[model samples]
Target: MIRLLLVVAALFGATGVMAQDFPNKSITVVVPVPPGGVVDLAGRLAAEALAGELKSSVVVDNKAGASANIGATYVAQAKPDGYTLLASYSLYHEVNPLLFNNLKWRPESFVPIGRVVVTPSVVVVHPSLPVHSLKEFVDYVKKNPGAVSFASQGTGSVAHLGSELLKQDTGIEMVHVPYKGSGPAMQDLVAGRVQFFITAPPAVMGYVQQGRLRALAIAGSERHPMLPEVPTSVEQGFPNFQLNPWVGLFAPADTPDAVVRKLAAALEKGLTQPKAIESAKAAGASVSFQSPQELAKTVAQGRAYWAALVKAANIKIE
Candidate 1:
């Protein structure tokens, strides 16, 4: 009986050590949005880059629904191994908790790997609208009241909250028009179906450049790199109004320190690659890599900031 017990213990110990050997097989990346979107594109780009660095297959799995809560919750409940990772935007970690009261996992449940880029949302209006700048836009909304309808990516999405933040700051009433995604929202904005849309740069940059939509302001403390001529909401008289929706990588909490460090380093290295830089730029994002500690601090601050806004505005998911 003593000999049998010793053999069983040895087998269990061996199993534990084998489990620690991460990436022995393909790594699965859970992309919490549908295909062809900016989030999906970023995940694919990162996965391909990381796979090349690690010399292993990195598969991107699209798990779309519930504004990313479905995929995020899956990662939160997954085992703390480096094999499974979540490729999500800032909305998943920082903004959703304020909108989604039924979310099963909080921001604290995941471990930060690092960030990819900070994508700034542009405050845009249809070309037909009389407003040219953010101040003029606010004045127009104030004069028109509920006549100005603002299109958003979806209910409780960053675009939605961004518009809400503007409302809170300017004290203007604009009817909320929620679309299935940013693509559709921008479509309506270009067609003048909606007078205004607070959307990400990638979705609206083309139209703004083509004169189909007019970019009134960038939603951040300073001007966006791509739209340097445009002023920020803060500069347009709404001081302290800044919203930057970022994309980040995360592993389940309690992942090995070595694995986390390895992934973070790889991500940092990947950002400097020409392809990564080009892809980010094409998506209207600026590449800014952070270490795990720095990422954690940013995540914490973002959560608190968005949560405070949600509370003050009495915002809720619909």
Candidate 2:
């Protein structure tokens, strides 16, 4: 029994030393989307900020495909050491598994480190659309039923899901147009090929300000500071119609608790820096930090929420 006790103590001591000496080399953060998108921007910003806090080199790797499964799967299968991490949006954790059938990695395959930023989706209509508000847009869609269409980044993306949720809530029937990426979707929307799109502010804010797309209402609990003039979906008569997209950091499951905590501390500190905050704001996002425990709860809630949304809306990917 004494030998067993001594062995356990030695193991614990080794773990402590490993945690103290964690991340001695450069760390790689994987973003499961193409560059120039919101997720990529967030990952690069976090990596740049975290490098300073951790006193180690940090780089971003974009693995854009299969609705983030490709990159997430890579990270999920990576070593549990504090070197390889995932910086992705909520869809991979909350919606993809529920929407796809043959996923190599499950949501539980990764452990949450913390949230980097949370931004609400904005409802933007092409300048040619004959609507000025959410109520008017709904009425217009109802009147013109199949004539109206909306664009989404991809079939199972948050933008797609958000539009699906809106259709269910408002009983509107509009054609769903899926694009390869947000850039293409935004281009089509601007060209008036699609009537409306509900996407992140950073994706559409410049267009809205430039008089290309008209802002109607934000799909969040409250209005964003960047578009204070626009009202929220709640204020527009759709209570509880908020869909805030969030970016978070994660490591493969079974990572050492001490190492996870250390990384989380660096992340929280790095994300709160003025430069980081400014970068997020410029991207139409807010720097929102949560502890590892809090992030786990958020992920759980998101999974439950999206599962129900997908079921009720009968949302599927083809």
Candidate 3:
């Protein structure tokens, strides 16, 4: 018993030493999407904020492609030291694993640090579509079947899952049209190439505000502060249908717990800065932070939720 206690104490002492000597150099933040997009913008904001808080430079690298698997797999396989972190969505860690049969990394390959934001997807339609509300959209889709088309940034993306959830809830049928990214999907939606899309508010805010697209409903339980006029899907009759394409930080699996805690603390401090708050506001996000454990729970719940959805809806990548 004495030897066992000694071993445990020695282990803790080593962990403490690791935490004390951590972050001796700059850290790299991997954004799994292309630059200039909403995810990239959020990552840059957090990186700048963390740099100040950690007293070390935090560099954001954009490695976008392959439904975000390229960057995700890169981070998952990186050294488990917390120096290389990923700023990505729930889809990459949760949904994609269920959608793709040959995902290189398992869902448990990364340790969730904490959530930075929860930006929900809004269900928007072309102005020409005869839908002024979620109910009307559902009714119209039912009547039109495959004639009504909805665009997504890519397969297995949150935008795709959001529409799939909508279809499961309302029993509506709409053809799926996948695009390279949200920009292209939004362009097609605006030009009438597709009638509806489940997209983040910032990606389509300009078109929605300019009257090119009509926002039928949001997937969040509460209306976004940026667009309070828009109602949530739950308010429109579907209950418990909340979907947020949130972006959060994660470290490679087996990363030192102390370093993960340190990053989480830095994230907490970063989210409180005035500059970070302004960035969140501009990005249509409510500045928020969570502890590493809280984030892990969120990830777990998200994985279970998406897995169930995929099973029930029979979603296939091909």
Which one wins on TM-score? 2
Misplaced by over 4 Å in model 2 are: none
lDDT of 3 by residue, 1-318 (tens): 999999999999988887888778989999988887667877887788789888997899999888788999999999998789998877887888887778888768888787887677788999898789988888887888888888997878777888888888888888889998777998899999999888778877878788988998888788877678999988998886678767888899999888888889988888888988888778777666878899889888888988898898788888
lDDT tens digits by residue: candidate 1, 28-130: 8899988876678778777876787777889999998888889999999998878888887987788887777778888888898888787888888988888
Q: How close is candidate 1 to the true structure, as a TM-score?
A: 0.88
TM-score per model over all chains: 0.88, 0.95, 0.93
Report the Cα lDDT for candidate 1.
Answer: 0.82
Candidate 2's error at 73, in angstroms?
Answer: 1.0
Best by lDDT, which number? 2
Instruction: Please state the error at residue 130 of candidate 2 in Å.
Output: 2.5
**Global fold similarity of model 2 (TM-score):** 0.95
Each model's C-alpha lDDT? 0.82, 0.88, 0.84
Tens digits of per-residue lDDT for model 2, 103-133? 9888898998889988788999998878899
Clashing pairs in 2: none
